[model samples]
Target: MTTAYWCVLIAIFLPYLATGAAKFFGAGYGPQANSDPRAFLAGLQGWRRRANNAQQNAFEVTPAFAAAVLIAHQVGVAEQLLLDQLAVAFVVSRLLYFVCYLADWGPLRSLVWAFGMAMIVALFVVSA
Candidate 1:
């Protein structure tokens, strides 16, 4: 499989990392919390809340990125190296975006989000 394809897998799993953070990284989490993870997650505040939001955002964005990569491969884009690099860059942007969200860096998080979206658009464009 191509590096971009692997990136698609990474993109798929990334949100779980954020959700894990939401469930484990902050106060009040325990084995009992796992019994009602949804409620536990909803009750989170501050950075924990942000982690949940980031997880949601990652889920929202992943499909677009994955579809773009699949479409790129389907159309047989000649610029394989470029596509892989863009995919990697998107993943990096996502990681940074997660951090920015958790740290409450609204401006930088938005910027990184836009960058990842641009990468998705570019993936489609390159495939075309």
Candidate 2:
């Protein structure tokens, strides 16, 4: 598989990783844990809340990213290197986005998100 294909795989699971972190940090393990998962998520504060938000954002971006990858492959884009570069940019920006969220870097996080979105857009543009 190509590097872009591998990036798609990572993007697929990234949200779950963020969600797991939220669950761990917000509710934790053991008998004392909240029985209601929704309640547990609702009660998240500070970094945990940010983590959950990041998880949601991860999910939100995934469909577009996946579709772009599929479309690019189906269309047989001439620039394989460009496609791979955009894929890497998307993954890296997303990772930084998650970290920025956890760190509460509001403006910087938004920029990172825009950068990731731009990467997705570039994928489609290149495919066209």
Candidate 3:
């Protein structure tokens, strides 16, 4: 598989990373949490709450990224390396975004979010 394809796979699971952090750091996951995970996560505050937000954002953004990569591949962009690089950058930006969210670095998080979206746009442009 191409590097970009691998990145799509990584993006698929990235939200779980943020959620895992929230669960591990905020409080231990228990039966109640397992029963109603959203309710349990909703009760979180501070960094944990931010982590949940990040996870939700990750879920929101991942679909576009995955679609961009797939569409790029289907359309068969000439710059395969460029597509891979952008995919990697998107993943890196997402990691940084998660850190910013957890650390409450609002401005930087927003910038990283923008960067990730730019990468997605670039992917589509390359496909075009």
lDDT of model 2 at residue 21?
81
Q: Which stretches of candidate 2 lie above 4 Å from their native place?
A: 26-34
**How would you encode candidate 1's per-residue C-alpha lDDT over 6-118 as one tens digit per residue?**
99999999999999999877778888987889899898899989999999999999999999999999999998999999999999999999999999999999999999999
Which regions in candidate 1 have their CA more than 4 angstroms from the true location?
A: none
Per-model TM-score, in order, reads: 0.96, 0.92, 0.97
Quote model 3's TM-score. 0.97
lDDT of 1: 0.94
* Pairs of residues at least 3 apart in sequence or in different chains that clash in candidate 3: none
Per-structure clash totals for the candidates: 0, 0, 0
Over 13-114, each residue of candidate 3 has an lDDT whose tens digit, in order, gives: 999999998887755688878898899899888999999999999999999999999999999999899999999999999999999999999999999999
Model 3 superposed RMSD (Cα):
0.9
TM-score of 2: 0.92
User: What is the C-alpha local distance difference test score of each model?
Assistant: 0.94, 0.88, 0.94
lDDT of 1 at 4: 97
Better of 1 and 2 by lDDT: 1
